[model samples]
Target: MRSPVLGAAALFAVVVLSLATASHGALQYGFYKGKCGTKDVETIIQGVVRQRFFSDTKIVAALLRMQFHDCFVRGCDASILLDGPSTEKTALPNFSVFGYDLIDRAKAAVEAACPGVVSCADIIIAATRDAVALAGGLKYQVQLGRRDGMISQASLVNLPAPTITVPQSIQTFRAKGLSTSDMVLLLGGHTVGITRCSVIKDRLYNFRGTGKPDPTLNPNFLQLLRSFACPKIGGDNNMVFLDDPSSSLKVDNSFYKQLLQNKGVLQIDQALALDPATKPIVQQLAANPTQFLTQFNQAMVKLGAVQVLTGTQGQIRKNCRRTN
Candidate 1:
């Protein structure tokens, strides 16, 4: 009964509304805001960090391993946090320090507070965020209810790169459904951590000469770096360092600023600053740390939503480092 133009307009409006609803649903199911509150999970996470289950260095390393795995495959499933000889042999970083001890402490605490309710995977994720907060960034709540992946496929550890190019890193993150904006926001986590020369020595010394130095780094900081350790062609572990000055103990957004200036420690770290697709996001976060934190929390929520094998899919391993 209506005119052709009116009918077409009505159909177009319906399509637009449907797409908008779908988008909103994706964000909500994948990235809804949640409260950390005084929940037992939060308490457990804080308790572990406070008690020092592993040294600050170890915790950060574990978090990086987890982030790498999560972004590589599906989402941040706590597979990297699993412990055991089988898992250890297959681990990406070869089971550096994160083990069942920390997971046991958290499990015990959570059990006492609220038994059999929280997932070990969720604890690891929350604890990582707490660790970030301790290092120097704003604290945000991570959503809970993630289940453990029963089958920890050690072979999957091969996915992450010890050193990655900026474009490759962007492609990896994009493959996981993250946008360039999400990639930069997430890398902001580097703002509070440390990187050993073992990771970036090649980028710093081999390709580029020590005399020139990367112009992005603060001249004074670069001078300090040069004094620490010299790079080599191949070494087990050498002593060279780049540290986040904001709060080495907490996680925050200042890392992006470092990237903007070319102080990013690794190839991938610096790449975020240089990439055309991601540079603007990095700049925006560098300009507004608080907003970055807020968005980072949201991204964490989404990352935690990847194909989780919860409920019956997986069981709580007696030891988090190994499959029981």
Candidate 2:
């Protein structure tokens, strides 16, 4: 009864529809099986962090702090952002309009795209990585389908290593199941940001005193540092590099190279360079920027794998900055 041409066209349409359905189904199943979990988490977190933080240096600094603390204890748990004792208490405000705004935006987008599918914890983790990418860091695909976490423990909030001693920092990371290689890689996040005097005053003044200072710092840079951070007054900390200024924003091995030259900012940054075990990896990362980017992407994927609540477990908060 049907014409041959019409029949063929109908068959083609059916085939196309079938393929699309199959693809969508595969994506859904893959997500449930934890295929794209890392990528989804990183994208969400990075997007939110970028939207929330106004200052690039502050955003990068907070991200580095988050990575250091998260990977230091159990994994990248987004716990470092919480306020409590045992935390570093960096100059960045915990609950700011900037922070919450971006988070809320991310949540809203995710909810619209895949309602009640992804978790806040996953979102936070993904958003941070995305922020790094936005800042010219390397890009890698991550997985998705993580759920939100209902439990927000006070203990988890205050678990960052406040002081920056090499031994203590190493101990902190080791406790978190991170190796020295991971520590060096994670610390590379300092490539793009500034440190406040309040955060490292003790390191600059108490650790080295006025005259000697950290021998790694450039003398001219040190003079600028004293003017900006040393007076103990509240002001912007001078920009420190994980890499050369030209490629500082890029997530690469230059950070390790900087460390090799004693150009690291914090004690933790310098210690990685001197440690024989970590020095090789640092040099490797410096030499092969692509390798560092690959590692960074993989680490981000791992970081996004923390506990998450999904599939009707947690409500989509209208405001990510505040608990609903």
Candidate 1 lDDT over residue span 49-95, tens digit each: 76673354456545644554543553444666654566533654554
TM-score of each: 0.73, 0.67
**What overall lDDT, based on C-alpha atoms, would model 1 receive against the true structure?**
0.57
Highest TM-score scorer: 1
Regions more than 4 Å wrong, model 2:
1-98, 153-155, 158-162, 208-212, 215-221, 227-246, 306-324
Q: What is the per-residue lDDT of model 2 for residues 46-83, given as tens digits with 9 covering 90 to 100?
A: 55566555455456545554544443333333333333
Provide the overall lDDT of each model, using Cα atoms, as 2-decimal numbers.
0.57, 0.52
Off by over 4 Å in 1: 1-39, 53-75, 88-100, 112-115, 208-223, 231-243
lDDT of 2 at 265: 63
The worst-scoring run of ten residues by lDDT in candidate 2 lies at 20-29
